[model samples]
Target: MTAARLGPQERDAALRAMADTELDVLVVGGGIVGAGVALDAVARGLSVGLVEARDFASGTSSRSSKLIHGGLRYLEHLDFPLVREALTERGLLLSRIAPHLVRPVPFLFPLRSHWERPYIGAGVALYDALALSGTRTRGLPGHRHLSRRAALRIFPALRRDALVGAVQYWDAQVDDSRYVVMVLRTAATYGAHIASRTQAVGFLREGEHVTGARVVDLETGREFAVRAKQVVNAAGVWTDEIQEMVGGRGQIHVRASKGVHLVVPRDRIHASSGLILRTEKSVLFVIPWGRHWILGTTDTAWDLDKVHPAASRTDIDYVLNRVNAVLKTPLTRDDVEGVYAGLRPLLAGESEETSRLSREHTVAHPVPGLVLIAGGKYTTYRVMAKDAVDAVAHGLGGGVPPSVTDRLPLVGADGYFALWNQRRILARRTGLHVSRIQHLLRRYGSLIHEVLGLIAEQPDLKQPLTGADDYLRAEVVYAVRYEGARHLDDVLSRRTHIAIETWDRGLAAAEEAAQLMAGPLGWDDAQIAREVEYYRARIEAERAAQEQDSDQEADAVQHGAPDIVPQATTVRV
Candidate 1:
């Protein structure tokens, strides 16, 4: 039913089930870790229900560097164990978990002097060795070294005087938000109730133990008394806030660290292989992403607004300054096509700065019937999830089954590779380009057939989104009908790349996509107009913020940006 899509109707029904009956686990966030926890709990034969204050992975989980690898930077820190663990997870995601989405990407590290080559090459060799030793490593090649002339052959953008040689290594990348939605949908396929825009206000306490939660439906302002035996707080940066809801202090602190990134078209930089340069503060990655190369990522402590971490002027300049140092042709603000900022939920101890904090995660039973899991990197969300569910299983009262999700396939895993091979036939039937079919298959896997059917029923749906020409109208229609895209921003910004890809930044196409979605989602004219205005104002504010150079200035400009009606109006959790 369309009710499965976390809209007004579905949220009410799911919350009723949670309130009227006991649940095995109730997850309080829809980020990757929260979705993973729900999937894990359900796979273990437990009844599960999940709710989110925003859309799935709307926070830190979605705004990642989008790499799934044993971190090369961690090797320099000498944290072999953490690197090994992350590498194992990367292997699992690429080899078995989501092979269609996560694929290998090669990165080149240029050496400026004669002595630098071996030093850098040794580290690259160690990275490859560690991945090979990990249980999850597969479908990736080993690291290789290149002479100065050979390196120029592959990446002519490197200045002749700037580098002497280079080393190349393998890693995996993904569409972070897309993967989070897939996890939420897979949990739904397993009969775990799911809803978004449902805010967890406070913990329902039976003495010292949490029984469920009092959640407010953001759309209708109706409160639900959800009843679950165990509630997992996987709220990422909002970990401490969720912890306070249960009236408990944390054993470990979670500090919010902001990271910024810039996206520029591929033609702006002439390079065959991607580049990874070492910045003074942290590592910088220029990874290839479709028609563009994603850059930046400044690791600085941020105590600003958690909801929307605006990219300060300094952050953008810092990235451009560092990357342009090694490039033959320097980059300027005009060269940048898009910019984004995301917070990192870092596990802080007695560290001087957030950058010094550990990426390791911890699951704590802050109180009976309440569990809080936070502070981990995106690449290892599944492992973090398995640990969180393992902790919750002990409180379920019965003998709980072990997690079997490692062997389980997600929503479209059954015959995805075979279906991907048949995209040519799909292209013929839908009268779409083979490139369009390939894009659908990679993003939706076996679910590609469902989207194709929408086009078949309505031939007009075959047309691409106006400004975001990369997406088809079928996607915009299906996002509301099936993927729980409630507002226009959700469809353009999260469900598709229109917000970041185009020069006008989705302003030109907002109304058309919203009009297409309103019918399927039962939205009125006012709602559609509100959605379009919010998106346009937000785009203007983001652009204004990008023009300013300081955090204070950028925050002030972005403050004027259109703000959404947060799901939880109280904003405590």
Candidate 2:
């Protein structure tokens, strides 16, 4: 396999190559599903090109709940197939695909009433059984029932009267943005042409048949055409917009459902395991992230600003009130370190509530030479990719091979276990702490050598960032040099997650990170200053938006900060 270095040089080469060649498949999104589609198509031996208007996973993909489970709540809806498929993919990710990035996390489902134990217990049992029923190895432990005392012992933060008992079940979690980048990297290794900050402005057509796309490099504002035999639209919430570029609506309509999450310090939540609480409209998860607890998710209709979904004060208050009901020590607004909102691309349905819409995906050849895929959960991204590529194959007269992604390990997964075992030795050799080595192993797996190589050349790179101590200075450099992070936001928001993980929302680290990124990205002092200013403005805008009472007000406030790269407008062909 080729080295999956998505640096500046590789990105330039990809753009030139994509423009020069007529690809067998061209994908129009860089979210998880689009990344998966690229990987699946390339692994199937097709010439593939993937373009993203912004950074990878900049949309809904990066803003997920970050769980890889069988959707235990889906069992109540009698959606066994969706749950089973997600479980299979979850197992594959943990064991075979991206072990370095994904790991199992335990969650406590607090039982409210005596009768609810047996009711929810059956659902949990079925969830476990469905996981086992899959062909892939079940990488997590089974669920366990706990008495009230045992539940309290494990989760002392829970209010005494809140639960009669609890059920502890295991699910996998991942840094969603990082995983998307890794997936694209793996796809690049398989010969997929990958380029971020490139937008599809319009579709190329030959007398009503979609043949390719007219694209613009967002960084340089250079317009070009990428000719492709088959075009796959995995544009998630922007599916309708992409379809409109083709001059009409596709077979399905995608509606945006806003979900908001609050990040609080882990010390605030005194639990050995994460909590899954029941809400009136949907389920709420208090997930255990590194050194922090991610409490969230308000599901409501959102029609504004798909790119930057804003979490209103009402949304934050709703989450706090819901989680506070079961917590012994109620959390306040002051406890929140960060807030983020993402839109779910649900297939529009008859139900008025966004929560009632389908999580299942659909693929349609709305026009010849064009395939549209939308509306799937994150965990089942591979399956969605496979199906989308299958549609592409059919469009290309059906000669494409089956998807080999299920058996293919991502770039960092192959030797992760060995690297993990030798972390202490690595630490000793590099004069770094074992904990630091372990952290690198979890994030980069066998690819830790690539990061350590930068540190070997510059000893100062080993030091942790001033604001986000969890990450090293080398990470910012790595994000620019190897991970295709073109801007400060790419590193702070997606690549390193310093934006949402820090108390100051990465404001303190912006100048340093921009300086570190300058050498590789060729950003002069002016550009560096501009990058820092843009990030600071973004942080301020988000803070202002979070204070608003409604989504409309919040969205308007969040839009105050213009995108660092001007958004490309779609032109009608």
Candidate 3:
């Protein structure tokens, strides 16, 4: 089967089809859950339309800790069902669903005291057991205990006094934003109309039932109506705001909880494995990325701007301080390469603290033709999508088939294992190093050929990007030609992760990448300069925001860089 193409022309055609065709389900939001819902619905023989207000996974889905695990901490809270369900999903993703994008990463949980070993070990044993109970958990290694001396050997960056011992366990990691795009691409392949940079202004309702939506293309300021029988709101942090469009609060409230992460170069930390530390409010993860280590997350209540969640000086200090307590050589602000903050859409409970709020999603059909699915983690998106579509199936009422997405591998998954086995052969054929071929295989899987094809046509595309050596020039072109990237920010921030991966926040490659993208995007000299200027302004704004102490101050500073794709000032839907 041919892979789906999501280039500019295809996106325009999708938008036109969404306006012209009557769909069975219209999924609003382009995050992981929305993308999953689109794939599920279309796979079930239902005509589907997926619309996003911003770029796909620009919100919380893009800014996660990048772990696909069973929520090990949730076991302490006795949320067995959530943990079990997530573990099952983790197994499926590792083995079946997206082997290319998702792979296992080892995490060492340091024990502070000798007495804590058995206690923590029991929890981890349960975690591994739950995962193994699943039918597809064959490849991942189980948890193992290591002596303090042995643990220190594996992670020399950890202070010897930081732990009495450690427990090592496996969890899968992903390039979260890329995974979302791949899911959408798979859905598009299955015949779903998809449009990004399109804002849903209002619901098209007939007497009290939502029939469709009034959407505007942010790129071209063109407004049109998309007609559908059922509309699913998977708008993440913006769920409550979308619900207000229909009438009342819609029987569910989603609270925004902010989480922050810091990216530091790998050489700064002499650790071979990732580290997971327990904190006062939540867990802190020092995750391993390709050329960098991702240290994150502070869980705090946030009521500020949701579009651009800013990580203030206070938040950065909190994370650094928490991780520094265990590091042999503490990481200073200068050591940090990037900082990002994302909001978690928690189902508002009686608890005042967002950390205590449940991650389990809630589905509600407050009205006849509308469904709202909110408050799940990145790991359980497929389940949430299945449930959302199941509700839509019920609403549709007939011989609507159940979800077959579990059996359906994503577009890149089909020939991945075979290609992975032949990485050396591919390296010889492409004249690229074996290590480079391995990187491409991990990213594009079987679709690596499409990327190689570009280099095959133009050998210059094989050269590494200007500042970000890990990525090739071919990737920047590929993002525009096939992956639906419209602006310089899209390529740097989401498509290749050059923004967070580089110390300059991709400023060094801004002009080079924009020039590369200009050819495919049909940008003139003026437009290319404008795109570069916008990206630089954004980097400066974020840098200034990081220096601020509070969310309010940071938000004020960050909003200085306005979005290129202007959204509606006022909503009628």
Q: Which candidate tops lDDT?
A: 2
Worst 10 residues of 1 by lDDT: 1-10
Q: What is the lDDT of every predicted structure here?
A: 0.83, 0.93, 0.92
Clashes of 2: 0
Q: What's the candidate order when arranged by decreasing lDDT? A: 2, 3, 1
Q: Which scores higher on TM-score, 1 or 3?
A: 3
The residue ranges of model 2 lying beyond 4 angstroms of the native Cα positions read none
Against the true structure, what is each candidate's TM-score? 0.96, 0.99, 0.99
Clashes of each: 2, 0, 1
lDDT (Cα, tens digit) per residue for candidate 1, span 1-573: 221354446655777787788898999999899999999998888899998887778888778888887888888899988888888888878877887778789888888888987788888888877778865447478888889999899889889987888888889898888888888888877778888878899888878888888888787788878888899999999888787775546665789998998889999889888889888777899988888899968999888778888897788999999999988999998988888899999988898788889999999987889888998888888888899999998877659888777776666555778978887887887788999988987788788878888888998999988888889999988888777777788888788877877788889899999899889778899998988888889999989888898887888888886556664544222
Candidate 2 overall Cα lDDT vs. reference? Answer: 0.93
Local accuracy of candidate 3 as per-residue lDDT tens digits, 460-544: 9999999988999999999988888999998999988889999899999999999999998899999999999999999999999
Kindly report which residue pairs in candidate 1 clash with one another.
Answer: 91-136, 313-549
